[model samples]
Target: MKLLLDFFPIVLFFVAFKLWGIYVATGVAIAATVAQIAWLRYSTGKVEPMQWLSLGIIVVFGGATILAHDETFIKWKPTVLYWLMGGALAIGLLGFRKNLLKSVMGAQLELPETAWRAMTWSWVLFFAVMGVLNLWVAFHFDTATWVNFKLFGGLGLMAVFVIGQALYLGRYVKDGKEVPVEKP
Candidate 1:
């Protein structure tokens, strides 16, 4: 359910792009993102920081795409978002000595400092690579192909990365319990 909610705007955008075109799809994406945020705020009494960032990016880039009659702004949106997230994680880990990934997921999973650091760094690299990938696709392909890649290829890569992360973390689990890491 949460996953579907997260992809709501993208799914709508893809459908709109197929049915209409880029400008119409951009409008649909903007409206869908705004609606998603409003629904989340109304239902949960708050929205996550990432969700708010997504809303801001969509509104700015999608608005530009529509108003200026250029699809380039929309095409760059994903790269900007990914880079921003990666930068935030990198800054939190390097500059502040805080693992933002652990801070968020700590309540759900018990892991050693080493594991947390590895996970955080992996995410940082993933986002950085994803940002570059988005740009590569956006520039190298046609608008329709980029739109297809945005929905399918982007999501496919994310799913694969997540599965790989889970497999990597699987080693830390033993007999239904988290294995404790020994201190050096």
Candidate 2:
């Protein structure tokens, strides 16, 4: 359900492109993105920061594609989005603080602060890798291949990485214990 909800706009883009034209597809994708975001806000009472940023990028690049009648804008969207996010994550690590990853994921995970810090660093690096990968594939591959990668490659890679992370996290669990409750 979450995947479908998140992917609704991209799907709309593809379908609209096929049915109407590139401009129409861009418009449809924008509309779908906005509608989905509104629905999310209404139902959930909170919106993710990432979602807003994504919407902004879609509007800018997708809208540019429509207005300029050029596909390059849409092609650049992923590269820009991922790099922006990755750069933010990487830059934000300059400050000293409690475990960054643990702060966000702590409710679901119990790990030493050191481990959490390492995980956070890994995520920072991973996003950078994803951004570079997006740029590489989008520029190097054919349009159809790029589109396919955009729609499928990302989710597949994410699923694999997440499963791998789960496995790694599982290994870090100690002494057959549940998520820890620290002593008062």
Candidate 3:
């Protein structure tokens, strides 16, 4: 349910793009993202940092795309978001005593420090790699192809990441307990 909610803006963006144009689609996406965030907050009384960051990126890049009359601005949106996340994770690993993944997922994941460290590092690296890949695809691919990749490819990568993470998490997760997520 939450996953579907998260994808609502992307779906809207795609539909709007098909109906109107890149700029209008981006604008609509930004609006949808904000509405979703507000709805989530009202219903749950909390929001994730990632969600807010994503919203910010959509608005910023979407506006840039509209203002500059170039899709390139929006194209780099993912790259910026992913790289920032990657850098934050990497920095957290280096600076903090406990792994960020462990802190967030420790409720269900009881893996050792080494495992947590590795997982955290993997996230950092993955996001960084995603950023680079987004840039490559945007700059090299055709406009339609880039849009498709931005929407479908990004979602595909996310699906793979979640599945992979579930596998890894299952290895050390306690027998039958749900993980606790921080919402702030």
Candidate 4:
């Protein structure tokens, strides 16, 4: 489904890494990301902003990894992307006084202003932490270990965080509708 499509590049990268090596894996990742974006655009008539951002990051870092014959660029790609996302959310909230999470999901889930603010900050924190975690693993571990972490650890952490977020948000909903609550 949509989830499989979203993870197509990462899965391909992992498989390529197992069969070949980091450089070939990087090439496969770059090509896979490009193909993924193209397929999305062709089928959906448009690609999401995040998807475009992913494509740009991969092309830049992956291209550097290939051309320079170094794995460091690819190693830093995830951290860079994560920090950029975290920075964007932080700036949007602090500078513009906007809650992007609320803006995006408000139509689907109604929650108090406080809840929205908390949710946004939670995501901001998650991204920041994830970025640091990526770097820690990338530098502390070997290439094979880093690659495994990139696919398994990264996705596992994301899944856990998402599940936690869902549980946290569950309290605000009842029977598919927002539960009414008093505001201070």
lDDT per residue as tens, model 3, 100-167: 77778877556667667888888888898889888999889877787788789988997899799778
- Give candidate 3 regions above 4 Å deviation: 173-184
lDDT of 1 at 115: 88
Candidate 3 to truth, TM: 0.88
Per-model tally of clashing residue pairs: 0, 0, 0, 0
Q: Write the per-residue lDDT of candidate 4 for residues 64-139, one digit (tens) a residue.
A: 9999999999999999999888888889899999988888887888789888888888988999998999899899
Return the TM-score for candidate 1, rounded to 2 decimals.
Answer: 0.97
TM-score of each: 0.97, 0.84, 0.88, 0.96
Worst 10 residues of 4 by lDDT: 175-184
Tens digit per residue, CA lDDT, model 2, 13-111: 777776776678778988999998999999998878889999999999989998898988988888788777666655666655545556568787777
Q: 63-131, model 1: which lDDT tens digit per residue?
A: 999999999999999999999999999999999999999889989888889889999899999999999
In model 2, where is the ten-residue run with the lowest total lDDT? 94-103
Return the clash pairs for model 1, or none: none
lDDT of 2 at 178: 55
Off by over 4 Å in 1: 182-184
Error of 4 at 75 (Å): 0.4
lDDT scores in order: 0.95, 0.78, 0.85, 0.92
* Alpha-carbon runs more than 4 Å astray in model 4: 181-184
RMSD (Cα, Å) for all candidates, in order, is 1.2, 2.8, 4.3, 1.5
Who is ahead in lDDT, 1 or 2?
1
